[model samples]
Target: MSDNPKPTVEGGSDLPGWEWDRTVEDSEAVAVGDSVTFSKDITDDDVVRFAEASGDTNPLHLEDDYAAETRFGGRIAHGMLVGGLISAALARFPGTVVYLSQDFEFKGPVRIGDRATAEVEVADTLDGGRYQLSTQVLVDDEVVIDGEAIVLIDEAP
Candidate 1:
C-alpha cells in the first residue's frame, strides 16, 4: 500500500484517441512505493475487436439479447479483455517487463463505454530481476478485477 498521490498524464496519446500516461522511470531503483497505471474507455469497437481476436464469442459478451436473459441482464465485456488493462498498466513499468505469472478474480462486470483503469503497485522485489505486484482494474470506484502478478524486468536492450 502506497500513500503516494496518483500521477496524471497530459495531452497526446501514443495511439491516436487512446489516452496512455505513465509517470515512472525504469532506471529508478525498485521501491515499495513504485506503481504505474493507465486508463481507457471500453467501447463497442473494443469488445468486437477482442471477441474477434480471442475467439471468445460467448453471447454474454457479443449478444445483448442473449446476455439480457442471464444474471448480467445485458452485454458485458470479457473478463480477459478487462484483464488486459492490467497488462497495459504493467507495460508501463520502468523497464522491459515480462509476465511470469498472474492470478485474477473477476468480481464485477465492465459494460461497454465504462472508463476502466489498470493499476499495479510494487509489493515485493524478488531476487533475479523479478517483482511481485498488486494488480487491479476499476470502473469508476468499483473494483471489477482484482489480481496479483509476478514479472521479470530487464533493462531495455
Candidate 2:
C-alpha cells in the first residue's frame, strides 16, 4: 500500500501531516470577558457553497431576482451560515472544545459581497462545565446576527 492516505474532502491539500496526542484532556473553564474575532470576505461562491453544504436553497438565498422582490431587496445568506462563522472564531482559539447549544437572533439580512466578521466573548460560566458565549456577526460594521452559544471544554484534571 502507498504511504499517502486518500483525500477525504474536495479542494484539500496533502501537506502537513497529522499527529495524534493521546494525553490531551478535554475540559476547561474559559475566562469571562475573553474574546475572539474573525473576518471573511463574503463571495457568491461562498454563498453557493454554503447553500450546497447546508441544503438550504431558499430563493432568498440562491435566486437574486426572487430575493430582489422580497423586503431584503437582494439575495440574503442563510442566517445559520452567518452564525456558523462564530465556530471558526472558536476553532482559531486555543482549547479542546465542544458545542453544547446555540441561541441565535437574525437581526438583519446579509447580502452577497458583504464582508462578515464575527466576534465572540466568553459571557458566563454555567453549571456542569458549560460556558455561555456571546457572539455578534457584523457585515461592514452593521450587526446582522446576535446570539449566545453554550460550550463545554476539557479542563485539566
Locate the minimum summed-lDDT window of 10 residues in model 1.
1-10
lDDT of 1 by residue, 53-156 (tens): 99999999999889999998899999999999888887766667899999999989999989998888889988898889899999988999999999988886
Per-candidate Cα lDDT values, in order, are 0.81, 0.71
Clashes of each: 1, 7
lDDT for each residue of candidate 2 in 1-157, tens digit (9 for 90 to 100): 1132222235673223221111112235357776667676667887899989988899998997899999989898788888887876665445556798888888998877777888888889788766798988898788899999988766433
TM-score of each candidate structure, all chains considered together: 0.87, 0.76
Q: In model 1, which regions exceed 4 Å deviation? A: 1-13, 20-23
TM-score of 1: 0.87
| Clashes by residue pair, model 2 | 26-154, 27-153, 27-154, 27-155, 28-153, 28-154, 28-155
